[model samples]
Target: MASRWVLVAVSAAQLAAGAAGQVIALSEGRAFDIDVLGFRGSPARLGRDSWLLGTGLSAPVLMLSVQAVATIRLAAGSSRGATRVLGSLGALMTCGYLIEKEARGALSPAGWNPTTTPAVAAGLTLAVTMAVLGPRQASSSS
Candidate 1:
């Protein structure tokens, strides 16, 4: 597949995940999983449908890894400087994912927390990289 298209798809996907994360974070009537778990002790006991939706936000977090590597590889064909930027973005994205996952695990334990800003920033960086890198094309022979 064309590398430029890959970046586009990944960027769009990142944006989607970001939106989902915000939705999960803002959903009302949600409970702290530990409290809910201790009380109800079952998935049904989890309460708040949004808790289930919160887990879905990670889909884009994981996608950022694929986007970053693909962007890095595509950048390798152009400028080393651009490659570094792509690589850095990719690393940040991965770190964001790990950080969010860890934070969610640490804080919520029973489900996703959707409260990490770093993850959101990392996702934004990935989206920006797609724009920064622009479309890939064969070098002009001139």
Candidate 2:
């Protein structure tokens, strides 16, 4: 029970982080682009496709929402397999993001922000750990 709640809390935090990033990207795209991606040009010059590609607002938010609901369902005694699958997906997404960032040199021209890489890595680790643990131990043994 306690473990399930912890998973829920972690999932909720992940959701919040992803959603907040999306919102920030949408509302103040120029700042987000500049701060996170190290873009120098104006937001207007970024264009629609560039903004969508750079911000990644859609897929990440959708994935995080799914993970949050799955974690909530797990806490509510839903199927362990379902929760595991969702958690795995969440973990994979985060890993992919981290890998891409690393491939790009993970550099922020504005200097490194602890909030960016560390937070995502923490979320990824948590999600992967939860997936590995599966549902509650008591339920799994039954």
Clashing pairs in 1: none
Q: Could you tell me every candidate's TM-score relative to the true structure?
A: 0.35, 0.56
Model 1 global lDDT (CA atoms, 0 to 1):
0.43
Write the residue-wise lDDT of candidate 2 on 1-142 in tens digits.
5666666666666666555544544564422223354633345643453333434222244465566667667667746655565557655655544544331232344434454544444455555565555544325535
Candidate 1 positional error at 73, Å: 18
TM-score winner: 2
Q: 1-142, model 1: which lDDT tens digit per residue?
A: 3554455456556555555454553443222233323421233432343233223223233344454455556534544444444434445544444444332453354643445444444455554554454423222211
Which sections of candidate 2 miss by over 4 Å? 30-59, 102-110, 114-122, 135-142
